[model samples]
Target: MSNIGVVSSCSCIHPLVHLLRPSIQKKGLHTAARLAAKDYYEVLVLGGGTGGITMSARMKRKVGAGNVAVVEPSETHYYQPIWTLVGAGAKKLATSARPTARVIPRGVEWIKSRVQELNPDKSCVYLENDKKISYKYLIIALGISLHYEKIKGLPEGFNHPHIGSNYSVHTVEKTWRALQDFKEGNAVFTFPNTPVKCAGAPQKIMYLTEAYLRKTGKRSTANIIFNTALGGIFGVQKYAEALLEIIKARDINVNYKRNLVEVRADIQEAVFENLDKPGVTEVYKYDMLHVTPPMGPPAVLLNSPVSDAAGWVDVDKETLQHKKYHNVFGIGDCTNLPTSKTAAAIAAQSGVLDKTISLVMKNKLPTKKYDGYTSCPLVTGYSRVILAEFDYNAQPLETFPIDQSKERLTMYYMKADMMPFLYWNGLLKGYWGGPGPIRKLLHLGLK
Candidate 1:
């Protein structure tokens, strides 16, 4: 039977919701009996995020829609890249979200369940309640996890005003609130010590805040400071040089090797531990604080055979195929691909992964290689953006013929207006890959 039919008929699909009502628990008992029946699919995509949905759509064309199933528990799918603009009050938070149900490809089975364990050797996954779902081919795209709790007082400190994080769905809008309520004093932004989904996001908000404050005639009163754990502003040298010039011009203070450790929200103080010095910390009084919490691989990947020592899915950087398990593949923020984790990276990786899987199914080798192409639309202001596109070597692999390191209004429109439309229609539908073809066309007869 179709997974949808079972979901509609049985409350077992939502065990937590079923547990809420004693009356439903009685019905859930009988539903558990039916749930015990094992299910299998030709292709099982483990997440419903950008990579998972895109791959599932591609897989549906290769295999039938009914033969593919996705295991995801969320009710809403977010276009997370937009949160920068959303936090800056350039876009509404509502515009960045859509119903997950609406985006799941038609005729594909949506198994609304959280993955508990991945038994790759057994060619199956263990879902919640010990339900087993086997598959011929598996795609692991379970993205990274945000650890606000790792800090001294956060995930709860957010409850207090004068603090917000653009990294989270819950706390994103609070950033706008904090910015608006700012009268004067230190408006501090942070970047975590670990690998983040969008490395450019932390500083992106800082730039927007500077612009916002200037526009509101509060620039002189506000001391805009950025504390980051990274030694450099950006990985790419070309973009970093450009950004440094902007920082000098705008008079934004950037302190390197400083990591946020605590948020005393009540006292309006933020504490940072210098990575260079052990057990040494400094506290700054802030009128408003924007935190970029430490991030890492999801808990499910911990101790799993499919993961590396650091807990990210172990996959080949070129092919995105599992080094050990040929039948398994990975993409996006979940994999240790040595690239900046962004939706643009996923779009490029999806194209390469699609080819890799196709060739593997034919008992052949994958010829295509991913260049680690990722783009970050560094929103410098409400109207300006520096389109930073680069590859594995941190070299600029720009798409347009013009200089991309400089901030431009056209790029801002592309980031704010065009990217979301393409994400929903092109990337999700498996039709739009990266800008490889367009780049080739535009750069014709030129180096």
Candidate 2:
């Protein structure tokens, strides 16, 4: 029972009542303070990225506008997948961003605070300024983090000319500058050893660079090189074979099992360590360099009770629900889903998660399963893209009937133009849920 209930039920002598009055008032003040520090919502989403915003919008519809809240610090929400084109000078960076206020579903509370700690067991998250936000259900959409500093002479190396990374918003424009200023010699690109969002982005920029050099009549003088940590070009066998053919046709150098370890930006030198042979390293001088730095889970997830040993959110791969906590869920690049991290995957997962949450709310089992659908619009050139779509088993799950392995301008238009429109108008608004329905419709239910 509450203090008020005790006080109302009490029937004591005047002297006893007077003595107890002081203690009761003190207790009341303490309770008030605790209440003031805390806020509650029916649903609390923990990120402002693609997944978080999308889920929040969906949750607002299921619950009510006033019942949902989102905790995010960023003032600007970026359509990050477009950054690959932005870096290649195909799209402007400004077009890829929007004010967070504009994207967050109206009437849904935006906490505008960074998450300090997640106490799932307590059903609360601690934010900056000792603020406590409790929720009946929690959604973790905190995205992956890039570690450019992990590589020697880096984030700082980005300060130097002719070196840039598409992975970062700050340096994406610099990639365009470097490509435009390239005179001759080696134009090198790297794929890190760590799991990165859009695993194909590193090489996508390389292909654009090669195409750009050729268009500028500098291809004859420039030597395009791709130093990747992976043994193969791409994960899916069909797409890998297609990309290999493109590499050969472009006359690009492929140094497999090599990971960039350092950069000497002052002298334009890049160092790579052979992943197969631990300490064996190689150095190359470059006129232009694109570094895809190591990526990992966000810092707050490290040593967190809600995360796995790898620091990723521990969630069921099919339902996207917390493996241990029934009321907690995870989405996007933050979860250990054993699949490529891409916005397309999030779109598909969002639909399944929505169904799962709805069922859980009604005390029923989740029957809808996520097939780990993901896509990579491998931009092979300024006008061509190999649309690679697949599932968790690394099997091709193409949306179109035509060969997705072949580079096509139509796919490029979808990646560069149509997708952004869908993202802003459909996905973020909780309308788009990937190409699954369309795939089934096109295949006449036979696929």
Q: Give the count of colliding residue pairs in each prediction.
A: 0, 0
Candidate 1 lDDT tens digits, 1-447: 001100100000001111122221111111111222338998999888888988988998899877888888886788888889888899999997887777778767778788899999999999988889999999998988888889997767888998988777788899999999999999999998999877888999999999999999999999999999999999999999999999999999999999999988889899999999978998999998999888888889998999999999999999999999999999888899998888888888889999999999999999999998888888899999898888998899888899999999988888888777777767777876687777787799453
TM-score of 2: 0.91
Cα error, candidate 1, residue 18 (Å): 47
Q: What are the models' TM-scores?
A: 0.92, 0.91
Task: List ranges where model 2 is wrong by over 4 Å.
Answer: 1-38
Clashes of 1: 0
Candidate 1 — which residues are off by over 4 angstroms?
1-38, 445-447
- Cα-lDDT of candidate 2: 0.83
Model 2, span 107-205: residue lDDT tens: 777877878899998999998887888999999999888788889998678879999888777888999999999999999999999988888889999
Candidate 1 lDDT at 417 equals 80
lDDT of each: 0.82, 0.83
